[model samples]
Target: MTALPQYERLEAPAIWREGPLAQRREVIVVFGDATLMIADGRSARALTHWSLPAMVRRNPGKRPAIYAPSEEEGEEVEIDDPVMIGAIEKVHAVLEARRPHPGRLRGWLGGGAAAAALALAVFWLPGALIAQAARVAPEAKRVEIGQQVLGELTKLTGQPCASRAGTRALTALAERIAGPSAIAVLPEGLKGARLLPGKLVVIGRETVEGPDTPEVAAGEIIAASLGAAQEDPLLRLLRYEGARAAFWLLTTGDLPETALAGYGEEVLANPAPPPADEPLLAAFAAAGVSSTPYAFARDPSGESVLGLIEADPFKGQPAPRPVLEDAQWVALQGICSD
Candidate 1:
């Protein structure tokens, strides 16, 4: 979902509790298109992003409204500001209204339990079952899981860098270089690029802020996309969580927080190796982006990445098109400024 225009600039103070036993700390809340962004009040480092649709209000018509991320009970946030509470309620109302009402479609879906059971019965060996789970997971569920993992990453990375104009530029850059994928630039934590589920890639702010030309950032994103193309990130998550996690997802349609715990740390600890040279060069050649910047970024002395530098596509000529427009690049540079 995209950022909601009406509440793009709206932010307020609220009490955030990470879990049932965690201490309640004051946090700054911002409304995104379909999520509630909670950030540290002092540092402004993002703490967690809550899905509004999955959220449930614990206190209705109460002065200080409390909300939780799931029906089974999980992290909670309390808001006293009337405007913030109203904005949150408004989005929740719309999402609830948009639910498929009890009709022919809903009835048909409800009656399809046999098909679901059939699917679950098609499992294989432990390794194959995990692969099958990831293979059949729907896009929406994949995106939801991706966002959850991203929030977990906040514990170590701090908030992702974003500004209205800067985010717009980021979206354009992602579409330009990586098809319909989403890319995030974090203020800190990541040193390079890390692929997340749901076609999301999180890169260090340096890739965007340190480069004079967008070509460098373009190269980083291109390389990350190449890694994702080679391996399904969802499979990585399932394999990390073990076979039981995949089985739960196949039977219950969602993984519990317990099942997903520590996944962010796992990803940060073990990043995927760069894609092979042949495919990397081919991708660079096809996108009309130069591979020299990427090679240089990896090894400034040009010792290790000599192959990329030597076989660099478009070495003698300019790219087919600029990676990003001048204005877009300028905005991207200041993404973390706010």
Candidate 2:
């Protein structure tokens, strides 16, 4: 196989324009990588990315190279630093002289043929891989993983909710937003809501009970589900785990028992996923919910929500469904407390 560049520990000197109003002054140069990033500190936040070989060819070894913008021109600075310029020149020479391995050339050809075959299979079989994945990912395994995660979450929270009431309320809200056909399943570490292979909607309680109202919770659930509709949930899982994981899932029908434990803690600590316009709009219209609260909750500045606000799906009309009844609302909030 042709050896790709080893990028493990190499660090390159980055350049930046020092003074205010300097043009194309800042440059961030990484020595050994597929691509290079260049930032101009002179102008207001000017950044550019270029292929490594392309950048090397453009700057040749003579002096410090300044990349001037097409629209405006700026005076170039002379870089006489022997050490810094020498390093860059050496890397450029090495890149030019390096040749692809013969074995790697054959492997690349084989990989291309394999990729073409895989594409043909996917096109003709449509979801054959995903279906295969689901069978190997048994419902029993999912339920087991879900229960384990629930156990950890309860421990983290110091106790289970006063009752299953919080879960019931969440489920109710999910039903309202997803319509009666949707099912809400709670699992431990799914940082955000997930649409499972069996048309199941998986969510984490933190997102539901986090600052947003039931409407916001419902919006996220529907958004996740819509994304799943476009692609299989199992495929997403495979993507996260890689082709080996996909193969394992297909062969065994279940992800490893400890598969999601580590991620659970991270999900609890991070910011929740935002409800984007397309899915949010679709879910909002379907559930008769307003996008206002969800949008603001995601972006307090109101700038990120321009899309939602401008194309308000619930424009000038009453929202279709109440996310949760009064009793359910109280129950959901008191979930951990109880």
Candidate 3:
């Protein structure tokens, strides 16, 4: 045999009585289907369309009388049934106790949505916009604007060696110089050098192989990374692209391709951001490398590099510790080749 629905039909109690004169009423109640159903004791005054969910408002008060809409403008027939009256009273109690405060609930829901929207506005949107903008740039534009600028570096009188081992050794040395805070900085060509959130370092082949000493490379990375922090790369991108373009990126995950094309080229040709003397001096000291090399690289004119020259914290100190064994350096350089 099939089981009955999880509800009980019962008489409502005389709890609906209120005011001076004795205004008696009868009611019936049913509990099932996720709501309490109410009706007149004789079924003569049933309100077929009253929402049980909406009846929860009467729970906290004295049991209210069962009233039915009438054809006459404002008339309600009284109900009179002991069982029905008792059931209705119980139903009213349950409803009022469980009624959720609309003000509190609305505040909670609105706050959560606002917080999510704010997070999207601040953190998520900018990167998405840049990625979207990046898509707009023609593939050829990267080749022309970006690649052409890096080609100028070929003018430097460096050896044409392509040995991965050399790059590894250089990386080892740079890591040694950078210590824990070192960010991996690669040349523009081989590494897209995307500065991810939280100042992570992205290295490319050129950074590893272009210079012999790790200190020089580490110094350059430090300089450039510091500049990025001070300037806030994300802010710069938003300013360049405008608010509407940035909004597109937050909802979507691509940037106009042209955004990075010419900019990357310009960045390569331009000297890395100059290090602040006090901070750079500390960094150089911690890395155990002389700041002189980095200073000179930035400004060959001694006049401009006076602070690094003057501070020269390593005037008589021993050189920085080695970051890797010669064999490890060799292996690291070959990692890219494999």
Candidate 4:
């Protein structure tokens, strides 16, 4: 027996034609587990169900995407809704992936069609593969990659400062912001902070020493985390190495050492773009930290990041809770002294 198709249910408005000469009618398209259900927009009644596996895109790259139940069918549906189009494309891709491979003779006969498919796959496959790799990668592998990247980074920025007391304090701060996340204070080179795989956050010594309060350092950590959430570090690494490298890592669970050699330098030379104010403020609020100090630190005159200041999560409150005690802050400041 065949297994049931698993997919999310989605619905959107669509213009559908029953035949080549038939007039178009506005209908509601509902994407189901294994089929596309067309419903009467007014009566909310089912009109037809198109099997997802048999559906095909009639136009390759045209706006107002169109689809048909089969190539020989005269009926077609034109959907302008991006969400519905994306859902259809996703389901089509999944179905295609599960289809059986063509025979050797068929492959030779369809060489031209195969070439077109290969071209499209080349453009679309790598990102999807990289995303899948990042999602399924084991924690041990993530840690291994993080450690390797950190090691390469040390060559450019020198070893991360290490004092027993400072290390303890940094760990405390990291725990407060993100449980089980680790922070490393480098001697120099990093602008603010950069997150690595395995929940490792790297920071410049200045972030701790330049500010009087731990809130500044905490804010930077929050910012780095927010950036990482937007773009996964592993995905960036895979993209930099290209599809071949990504495929190799996907199959073997290891990245080529050469691919990561200059990554640290690249990160240090190019500062990460600041996260959006809404998300950044949300991050600060979630951590019970203030963004005012970080805003001032970014621009002493407070002209550029005025939004962060005006919308400070802890603004109206009486001096939000301290990130660390006086002694802990002092220890964290001296992290590079060793």
Write the residue-wise lDDT of candidate 1 on 1-338 in tens digits.
32434312346789999888999998998766667889999999999888867888898988789988888776888888664675566555445444566754765655464444333234423466678889999988888888888888887889888899999999989878864378888888787788788888888888888877888888887887788677888998987775556767887889866877788788888888988889999999988899998899899999989889899888888888988899999999999996
Kindly list the per-residue Cα lDDT of model 3 for residues 1-338, writing each as its tens digit. 00024311222322232223546455444433434444556753643333333443322333344443322233233344332333334444444444465666766666655565454334323344344444454444333433332333323322223346654554565456553222333433433233322343344555444445444445665565656546644445444444344444444443344434444444434443565788878777766667765666556697898898778776566465544565755554454454
Rank ordering of all candidates by TM-score, starting from the highest: 4, 1, 2, 3
Q: How many angstroms is residue 105 displaced in model 1 relative to the true structure, after the best TM-score fit? A: 45
> What C-alpha lDDT values do all the predictions have?
0.79, 0.51, 0.45, 0.78
Query: Which of the two candidates, 1 or 3, achieves a greater TM-score against the reference?
Result: 1
Per-residue CA lDDT of model 4 for 1-338, tens digit only, reads: 01123312456789999999999999999866567899888997998999877888988778699999998969999888664675567656545544566764555546644554554344334455556677778888887888888998999899999899899998889888873368999997887888888878899988998988888888888888888778887777766655445655776788755768678777777656899999999988888898999999899999999999999989878445678878988999998886
lDDT of 2 by residue, 157-233 (tens): 44433458777886677567654234343433444465544555555556556754676666666676667556655
Note the residue pairs that clash in candidate 1: none
Task: Output the TM-score of candidate 3.
Answer: 0.41
Model 2: what TM-score? 0.49
Off by over 4 Å in 4: 1-124
- Stretches > 4 Å off in candidate 3: 1-162, 177-214, 257-259, 269-272, 322-338
* Cα-based TM-score, every candidate: 0.63, 0.49, 0.41, 0.64
- lDDT winner among the candidates? 1
Prediction 3 global C-alpha lDDT: 0.45
Worst 10 residues of 3 by lDDT: 1-10
